[model samples]
Target: MTEVAEICSELLRIDTTNDGGGDGPGERRAAEYVAGLLDEVGIEPHVFESAPGRTSVVARVPGDDPDGLLVHGHLDVVPADPAEWRVHPFSGEIADGCVHGRGAVDMKGTLSMTLAWARENARRGARPRRDLVLAFLADEEATGAYGAGHAIERHRDLFEGCSEAISESGGFTWHEGDVRIYPVAVGERGTAWMRLTARGVAGHGSKPAVDNPVAELARAVARLADHRWPVRLTPEVARLIDELSRALGAPIDVDRLEEEIRRVPRAAALFRGVLRNSANPTMLNAGYKVNVIPGSAEAHVDGRFLPGQRDEFLETVDRLLGPKVTREFVSFEEAVSSPAEGLFDDLTAALLAEDPGGRPVPYVMTGGTDAKWFARIGIRGYGFAPLFLPPGLDYFGMFHGVDERVPVEGLEFGVRVLDRLLSSESSTM
Candidate 1:
């Protein structure tokens, strides 16, 4: 096995599942494993836990420039049910030229690549142009309250002088017909986790009550779930569409953009969610007994809004909820966007160097990342892990999905691209 794959497999076997709100087997073990690797490379690492067992590790490699790069990856994986997988989720088994495990794709694989790159450079007595802050974080699967969020809040010094950061969900190969497209994430939709509550007079189930909270809540949820959010294309997504059109040599019709987007093979699936605001009812609670009507009903919605659309999204949600139901934010993080023209050229050059004819495009992630937290401290985050996978592999599908796995060759590819990116003098065209 390649060094990158071995590191990923070893980390995967540790079982660092983060089940939100400070639950599950914390990432202490995985954090220790990563710190050990960094320590062996003669780099001193600082490890700490925001909560018991919720550990994060941070280390830095000095470069010629003071303001350097920050490359981070979460050590925690989403809880994987062993019963739902063909193999044990945490087994970290290698077969069929793939590393089969929980975090093979969602991020541990990238973490492994980052560690391997740093170790290799250390062994060869080589360093990059700017300082490199390597952070192996915890609690990413659970909203990063105890991981990136914690580190940024409690230990900001670790990331000092780092203006740009790179993390997960990008730099992977996407195949569309005869083309190989690499998407590097430049923006992410905001998180608007909300809770709705409706209160009314409690009454017997048989009685014909005019205002039943459960019925009201059900109606509100139905409206919110069924509401078709209008297409509000952000700049990042617009650039992606335009770039894809140029690369594919296809004329794009702005009025018929949605239809045109769907025509592109892999582009459609990635761009669909970012085209509009979305909210889906995830959890519902109402009556305790079938015969009795509860006075209050509650529901949880997973809502996401495109960048610069929070006000409009909230107003729309309020309108859908009506006067009978009241909604409040469970957790809210604003959408993040960085100028697509910056640092993207370097990423594209690195991918082309590894696999010529590969087209790298800017992507707007439908979901949020710990990048939101880092943005609090004037740091711009880019999703640039750099993985080249086979055309047949559904790279995005493996994220927190059943049978999550990464190709052995893909891990090696990431190591090379990331090493080049880190070693480069400038990440600009």
Candidate 2:
């Protein structure tokens, strides 16, 4: 097999930063690079650009069976400042036995493993048990509108027979004493990115203003920020707690979940973010100048609700902001869940086969991914990007953190695990 690290370093050198805003340089260069790599191995690649220079690449490698498994990763990384890093963020430097770069862990590293594995398979004339639909997507750091969303909306036929998908955000090693716990994400919290607007009569600097929009919005923002969201565990989270309890050989009291979690901090860390609904005031805007009380004020909130808690979450937000403020969605996407029985077992088996010391568990992601977009088309997605890291590596904190990097050995381990999973007959629908 080809050196996955070399592919990763090459990819990281290409700066494909998605700044959420539309104006950043798009993923065209990276998409072309990915296309060329696949083409070199004789795998026909289909490249799509939703807008000018916003590109995504897709290819279907035929297998022994007609059933398909979609393996995907985004080509973009969250923007990084070069001054804040030990190495330049865009320079895909290999140092201290790790690949250091912006997208090393956030996604491009995983894409490298996929690309290298696929290339090796193609070169050897090897085929997976199930057809592999490889998608190197764009815009996942934002809303995936130019990536998975566009593909699903305009070109649904690209993923015709695919029933399940594996993507970013899971299958990494989480240490629990001697055992390495690998959490496989079966679901994720729904996104309710909302924009709140408050309107009041314009007023002078020193005037006694009763209906100050700024004050009204500030109070609402504070309430939303400080309000304690009740614990509402969905099926996936509940299952995770149960699995952890068994794995650790300690009972977890659901009623006293906060207290119980304190005892098993390591296991609790896995699902702490998805235990309840969360809303934090991310951005606030009120007055143009300090003196004048603006007629209108607005704020943006980052809100996430557990699966099946959307109605209750929205209702509570409306009540907290009161009658003065009205809210609209900046971007809204539903929570998604896939069965953790069949293909999930296949994933577990693959991981265990690769590393006997590893224990596989199901988890629900706190943040959203391209999985939710693909869920719209009845495709179940799982977070199955496998990586095995040495102890002391803060894998979770490096998602978009400074000095984001992935261990070279971890990428190699992932390649092996992926090969085993794809070769399994049970992977087919």
TM-score of each: 0.97, 0.97
lDDT over C-alpha atoms for residue 290 of model 2? 78
What would the TM-score be for candidate 1 when compared with the true structure?
0.97
Q: Candidate 2, residues 72-148: lDDT per residue as tens digits?
A: 98999999999999999889999999999999998999999899788877777778889889999889999899899
lDDT of each: 0.87, 0.89
Q: Which regions of candidate 1 fall more than 4 Å away from where they truly are?
A: 24-26, 424-429
lDDT for predicted candidate 1 compared with the true structure: 0.87
Candidate with maximal lDDT: 2
**What's the residue-level lDDT of 255 in candidate 1?**
75
lDDT of 1 at 403: 98
